[model samples]
Target: WDSVIDGNTSMEQFLNIALINAPLEKDYTILGQVLGNLQQAKNYLDLMAPMHASYNSKISKALSQMSLRMSMESYRNRDFQRRWFDAYISLSSHGEALKHIQSLLQSKSHIKGLSIDQDLRWAMIRQLNRYDYGDAQALLAQEKHLDQSDSGEKAAIAAEAIRPQSALKRQWLNTIENNDTMPFSKIRIAMFNLYPAEQKLLSAATAEQRFANLPLMDDKGPVFMRSFAAALIPTQCSAGNINAISDVLDTQTGLSQLARRALLETRQEEQRCVKIKLLLQ
Candidate 1:
């Protein structure tokens, strides 16, 4: 494998070596280790388009056999299950991947008091969204333990609610407003796009106004600046607040290059719109 990665050995030669040294017995541990190594190799090969599909068959076979041998207890671990699911999804279509995930979800017993892995849960949510939004909402409704305090879970739930077919937009807005731990600027921006009037109403209800009283350029950290810049630029453009947009463009301390570019584009577009309006008049 090292020789293959280092370009000393061809992939075909590496495959031949792997096949020749294959153990006769069905050892799950060894299979798991090999699967990990193959996954790494696949990542490297992904950069070369011609060689991308070469490892698909081997990876799929390993995942199938590993799934069969591994117990439900083993699958309860997030890292273990994520590796398997990610590999499976990479090789299979969305429908096939969802079918396999649903089978695993159905087979596991919550009576063991083990929590469902968050990655598995999020994967199901995402796949279900692709497959059926109604079914995804139903599943979300059934999940009683979704903690709003956990930023990841909150983000996932927010993502689900923002989907076009979701009817829980208002619920998600409330959840985002109440989440005091993480910055809500990103979520607010999403909500603003989808339900501007409702987002404005929610923003008014909250004491901390959206993107209005952000920390000064020197005071804020990178994360805060990024989130604020991401949220502010879009909102200002949409609201036709060109002055606010220019202010963001003038500030040099915290905004990322991407943010600056977006603001510049937005300002130019706004000016173009104004010129078009004047010409019409």
Candidate 2:
């Protein structure tokens, strides 16, 4: 009955209830009573459907930007993306919802206070990647400060995140570090500030150097911490491509085999390199 009343229940719950009870009710009046309950529940749902839509719509707007910023955190994850997908798929016009989140994340409060929680940041990053570089760069700049400040703890965070220099990580970090004309520090500082205290300091150094320089100093080798660091380091040199890459990495669907193939194919294209060059050019 709750399943019939609450739209939020998963399909599994519905099936489990039907399987357990459908056979037990053999009397006609009992069956009719169940049918009446179902009809009444349906009426309630019909009344509340619009309200659900409105609620999710509001959540989607807040989440989209929050999720984008979250994607840049040391804790972006698939579960966060799944929630965002749920909110997004329910909307009739997602554009307003997306921009609302983006605006909040990019607002002064999110950048300065790091109030955009992990789940919300994950949602926004998924949305931010759909736009062009200018938009993505704007998003990264919000949290770049978190990536630059390198205290002892910050260095520890970097060691965990950037230690294993994948070929892609090495390439991207090298490009950003040496790009004197673009003032990588300014750009990355903006990114770091978007993070909470420790993360803001850690991400800066990790984002700056080539992967070769990022080995951990021993004591912080937990699997998830290291995996998170490696994955969060931008794979593309330009903020734009990096943001797009972030979008792909931010969501479960975005990380699908097809998405990986697209990213790999993109990496193979030298034109993308030229486009990155043009950010400074």
Point to the candidate with the largest TM-score. Answer: 1
Per-residue CA lDDT of model 1 for 1-281, tens digit only, reads 56554445665555455444533325556756665655544433332223334454454455444443332334555545444444453333235445655555556433132344665565555445434433566665554245444545554544465454434544554544444555555455444333321132222333123333343421444654454444333321122446756765675436556556656765765554333223222
Q: Measured by TM-score, how close is model 1 to the native structure? A: 0.37
* TM-scores of the models, in the order given: 0.37, 0.22
Q: After superposition, which runs of candidate 1 have C-alpha atoms over 4 Å from their true positions?
A: 11-35, 44-58, 71-97, 106-119, 123-147, 151-281
What is the C-alpha lDDT profile of model 2 across 171-210, one tens digit per residue? Answer: 4444433444644333243223222211223334454442
Per-model lDDT:
0.45, 0.37
Model 1 Cα displacement at 205 (Å)? 38
lDDT of 1 at 171: 53
